[model samples]
Target: MAKNKGSSRKGLMLVVLLLVLALGAGGANLYVLWSQSGKTQASELEDMPAAEPVPEPPHYVALEPFTVNLQSSQYDDRLLYVVITLGVADEQSKQQIEDYRPHLRSRLLMLLGEQEDEALLASGGRQALAEKVLALFDEPFAERLTAPQVKEVLFTEFVIQ
Candidate 1:
């Protein structure tokens, strides 16, 4: 009976030892796989290209309101009231616009004087006028090599009467 008991105890000890070894091996394999996956994710992130930087918003230079007498033969009393805002490329361009404000205003008055009320009141006329204004400022200020970067001509207010 003692011999049978001793043999049974040894058998149980062997089964327990085998179970512990299997559990340890399984845990080690899981750890290695987890670490390898983490490294792969990190390497993939490093291989990816950097994201693009966001562009800056456009700078603006607002001109005071302009009131001009429109060209009309029949009515002889047509008028146009407009407020313009210039979208400049940079601070230097904005300063240039400011520096030449008076000359610009004079040129604008002359251009505005030639537009008929009917034409200005028509569809897309305001846009056409804006383009013309942009062209007027596209030239270089003074003797500078680069032109004043006037990107857009926006009309905040327009009235033809």
Candidate 2:
């Protein structure tokens, strides 16, 4: 009976040891798989094409205030005082606009001077005026074959009297 008991205790110890070994092997396998997955992901990222760089914000160029006499049917004369700020596509466009400031101002004055007071005072007039201004700026300068990229025409101050 004592021998049988000793043999039974040895059998139990062997079973426990085998269980521990199996668990250790399983853990090592899992660790290897996890490490290999991380390496694969790293390699995939390296193989992918680089993303495009973020675009720059729009640049603004503010022009000096313009005051012009508005064409009026009435005996009383009318005037328009406005401040224009241009949103250019790039630095080059801004530079081009600055370089041709005098010519631009002259053209703008002529355009503004042709405006009727009643028409300018009407609703949607400001929007229409902005569109016209944008079109005017779209024209190419004498020095450059390509037009300066004028993205937007903003009216900072608009007053008609």
Candidate 3:
């Protein structure tokens, strides 16, 4: 009977110790949460750049559609037609593109006319061509005007047949 009583007391002490440890952990967690609650996110946002007045879309200039004959060395001739919209960074760049329109158009036409069907018909070829055209806009002009920053060359209509 004495041994049984001692065992029961030990079990109770063990349970009390466990409860105390759990309560300490919970209190520590609550302390952490309380500290975080005091810090408002609004205070941090003031230091960051304002995201307000959401930006408008980048301006663009629509170039005349291009139609080129791509005569394949491997197969039948395929005609390529692409409708392009060149993204200009700002009003100044737009004006630059308009000013040099004749020279720009001629350069683009020559580039397109030279592409053979075997190359243009490939899956990634059209995208590669678009990148090349974008690079062309950055080339130097006779006036030494600021290069037309062409952010993107969107092919609104692409057809190969």
Best by lDDT: 2
The ten-residue window of minimal lDDT in model 3 covers 37-46
Model 2 lDDT, full chain set: 0.92
**Over the full model, what C-alpha lDDT does candidate 1 score relative to the true structure?**
0.87
Expressed as tens digits, the lDDT of each residue in 48-129 for candidate 1 is: 9988898878899989999999988679698899999889899888887788888788889999988988777779888888
- Clashing residue pairs in candidate 1 are none
Model 3, range 1-161, lDDT digits (tens) per residue?
99999999999999999999999999999999887766656667767888789787789899888888776776667788888898888888888888888998889888888888767777898888988898897666566566778899899998888
Model 2 clashes, total count = 0
Give me the displacement of residue 25 in model 3, in angstroms.
49
Give lDDT tens digits, candidate 2, residues 1-161: 99999999999999999999999999999999999999999999999999999999889999999999999998378989999999999999999889889989999999999999888888998888999999996678785468999989999999998
TM-score of each: 0.71, 0.71, 0.63
Worst 10 residues of 2 by lDDT: 137-146
Q: List ranges where model 2 is wrong by over 4 Å.
A: 1-34, 40-53
